[model samples]
Target: MIEGRMETRTAILRAARTLFLERGYAGASVRSVASAAGVDAALPIHYFGTKQALFLEALPSMPDYQPLLEGDPDDLGERFVRYVLEEDGHLRPLYLTLLRASDAGAVGEQLRDLHETTFVAPLESRLAGQDAELRARLAAAVVGGLMYALWVVGDDQLLAKGEDDIIRRYGALLQHLIDDRL
Candidate 1:
């Protein structure tokens, strides 16, 4: 009975991920995801409490940024770019999903909270001097824009550039934002 419940929960989460990716937050409903998982609509609510909670659970876990933070400050930018482009490549689809659903009420709030906890807060802690919050947010924007351009928009020019070239160029920009004082 316990195993069965776990299976049902996993199925719901899996279905939620698929539907959320395909239809965005506003379009995908608990009923639809439950149907996709072959479960009753109430099951999702019973297990996850809310659609927003289910959506958050369905997202892939974020890559650890500790290594980048712990690394030499001089190389932090390049490390971060490489980490996102290579190590966290699998998260591109998830990022796209989040971007698509970002404007939805609950999802938008959750996204902001996630961003603050996952990116801004951690980076801000490491930053020194004035405008640390602004700098952290700027760095996050650079990464977000890169993901949008490369994965979402599929920019030809950016795609044409070798990964190394992008790392070197964008890395410098991120490094400046991270290390420069306001």
Candidate 2:
């Protein structure tokens, strides 16, 4: 019974994540997620309370390249960039959902709180040796810019070339901006 429940929860989350990314909060309904998950419409609400809650539950709570953060900073940057360029990178979908939600006042505030608490806090911890707040903010800006550029440009040519290429180009640019400013 417990195993079956867990499987259903996982399915709901998977469906919710996909639909939320594809349709944003406004367009994605609890019914839609439940249908996608092959469950009753009320299943989402029963498991997660509300559509917004389910959406947050489905969002990436951490970057997928967490192990890289435990290694060298340079290596981390390369791995992070590579992960970003990879098909269906965890960060990209969440980033897109948040960006889309930002247009709705209440949803935007909710997204901001969720991001600052989960996303930003983790990155800030990774930047601890680099003067904490400054490094974190700089890193956030760089990531935001890169994500926005990738979304707008609709191509990963620059990102897909190689991790070495991303590091040599964007990493150097980011390091100069942050290190010099610090």
lDDT of each: 0.87, 0.71
lDDT of 1: 0.87
Error of model 2, residue 47, in angstroms: 3.5
- Write model 1 residue lDDT over 102-176, tens digit each, in one string: 876787887888889888999999988789999999999999998888888888798578889999999999999
Shift in Å, residue 55, candidate 2: 0.9
Give the candidate number with the greatest lDDT: 1
Error of 1 at 74 (Å): 0.5
Stretches of candidate 2 above 4 Å error?
1-11, 64-66, 74-79, 86-88, 103-131, 153-166, 177-182
Clashing pairs in 1: none
Q: Candidate 1: where are CA atoms >4 Å away?
A: 1-3, 26-29
Provide the lDDT at 121 for model 2. 61
Candidate 1 C-alpha error for residue 124, in Å: 1.4
Worst 10 residues of 1 by lDDT: 87-96
